[model samples]
Target: MVEALLEARNVVKQYGTVRALQGTDFSAYAGTVTALIGDNGAGKSTLVKCLSGVAMPDGGEIFLDGQRILLDSPTSAQRLGIETVYQDLALAYDLDAAANLYLGRELRRPGLLGMLGVLDKAAMRNGGAGALANLGVRLPAADAPVGSLSGGQRQSIAVARAVAWASRVIFMDEPTAALGVVQRERVLEVIRRVRDSGVAVVLISHNMPEVLAVADRIEVLRLGRRVARFAAGDVDVEDLVGAMTGALEASALGANDVEANDVEAGAQTGGEGNTNGGNGR
Candidate 1:
């Protein structure tokens, strides 16, 4: 069997009396979009944080390319070709799109001017434009400040930045949370382009229609662990909701069987997973 490009096994996370993740397992393959969906307190955000290196798991292992790896910090994850686009779409409102794309990884000029920390603005502008263009994102003005752009454009810039740097896996949390129909479709197009580039795209979303529209595979989380897995073509919104709420029997789903321990752990939590740790989904 081909190993997943990224995988998590028996992952656990705790927040002082509340367990956010209880031996959760996850996997993402290259050249595919894997949707991670769950209800509000299902530990989606916590798992993303652990995988993206924002926080360390209290227990369990994470693997990249089938090799066990440690993600101690966000920078460490970035070095390993892992990037995340959070819902807030962290961008400098005062800076132009080009500047925001190269916010931290700025290109520098060669020679003494480079030594003096001079940024290659023109190169970045051209490169940023190219990157956005490659993803089918068209801005009204390349030089326009991100603050002045529409919500969709800003979201696209955030995705573009992640795509420009990510070579292995990209985790997008709620990429299309709030947007008009056109903008949402545009961002979904960019996601398709990224997936086609052979990078594993792990999408965290609550929009069932959007998830079914874009995801090749779907993993359902309940409480803090995976309850079901399905090929997007095999399930509908009802199935997804059933998995998330534990309304349907895991064994009857004909998907991956839910582990017994995970179900028990979830029961022990009494649905307090989201509130105790400030680990809101």
Candidate 2:
């Protein structure tokens, strides 16, 4: 309703003989968690790659703030305020939490030393500390090596890093996949905080309850296409499972159940499809 902060129009991707995506149109808005849910092999990973600049779609367009743009590389996407936290967390094990946060974008010392590429360890450490605090995430210490942190703590650092730098959108790919129940809840809270801070959060997950609990809107991807969209409040877990499996009929929930105008947009792009249970990831 606020106008899509990010949208993919008729996006397509392929892998040799496999058509990973069939003109999938996806959209996300500011200050909301838009869940991308599907069985494995639903092209969720492919779509994530495309949206995050890890891979280009074989065809289609991606728009940000109503302006069409190209995400040719990860840096390009980052420059455009798009950041992704993959399931892997991608942290530097040997480096401290603060160091991981400032991995490639470390702050520099003042004046000539700064010009000489001298690392500003103190500044980074303090900034990391503040950022974590701002996100309500408690860790052992910013100076603690990431490898020494718990799974939830590491995931928190990853989310905190993204939240600190993400100006527009953040893509979270199965962020709660490997966590314990408590850790999962912790990350979910961090995600809610990110959404509350006005960042467009795209959450990809297989856990229906978690998706329903945290997402503002849910987009069901079946095979390589989007089959349905649901307002988080309008549909229950049964409805989502039905939609994902094509058992409830595509667009069965109808657009009236949602507040956004584009709720039915995916129906126009969906078609015959197949997705391996949960094996695609």
Candidate 3:
């Protein structure tokens, strides 16, 4: 089996009296779309934050390419080729597409101008346009402000920025949310292209059909811990819902049937006692 490009083992995170991640384990392979699914308050966001280095885990370990690593900040994660496209898109509404793409990491003019902090606008614009084109993203105009673009176009720009910088993995939180059908499909196509380019895409979304449609693997989280893992082709919406809601143990399908369907619903235990269902190999 291929070693996971990114892996989190027994991760734990707490906020005051609330425990956000309870020994949750996650893995994302290179060149695959792994969907992280759960209901609200299921710790999906908490885990993502930890994995993306926006937040630190209270305990447990994270590995990149089989070596343990510490992510002290978002910059640290980015330095190691990890990027996140948040649900908010986080693009500057007033900035044009190219500017937003290189918002924090702007290219500089050469020699004295670069030393004087003069940005190479033309270089940035050409680079951003090429990145978007490689992802098959279409914008109405190369110089248009991101705010002027459609929801999908904006989302695509955010994704393109992440993909342009991320050499290993990209965490996309609801890339298709609030988008029109055409826009959503366009974003999904970009996701497929990214995966095909050999970058691990960890997708977090509540839309079941969309998850099933794009995810190569699925991991279901409930009450701050992962309760099931499945190959996307091996499960349907019902199975995914059952796993997220803990209905797999109570539903008529029963344990044997779940096994038959190749679902590894975690042990019927609580808290840290719950184990990962199975590796979505």
Alpha carbon lDDT of each predicted model: 0.85, 0.83, 0.84
Off by over 4 Å in 2: 255-281
Q: Mind giving the per-residue lDDT tens digits that candidate 3 earns over 1-281? A: 68899998878787898988877878899999999999999999999998989998877788999988888688999989999999888899889999999988999999999999999999999999999998777687899888998877888899889989989999999988867888788889888988998999999999999999999988888888877777888788998898788777533434424233423344234435224312111
lDDT per residue for candidate 2 within 193-251, as digits (tens), equals: 88898999999998999999999999888878877778898888989888777787644
Regions of candidate 1 where Cα sits further than 4 Å from its true position:
255-281
Ten-residue segment with the worst summed lDDT in candidate 1? 272-281
Model 2: colliding residue pairs: 41-280
- Score candidate 1 by TM-score against the native: 0.89
Task: Give per-residue lDDT, candidate 1, residue 80.
Answer: 97
TM per prediction: 0.89, 0.89, 0.89
Ranking by lDDT: 1, 3, 2
Question: To one decimal, what is the Cα RMSD in angstroms of model 2 from the true structure?
Answer: 5.1
Candidate with best lDDT: 1
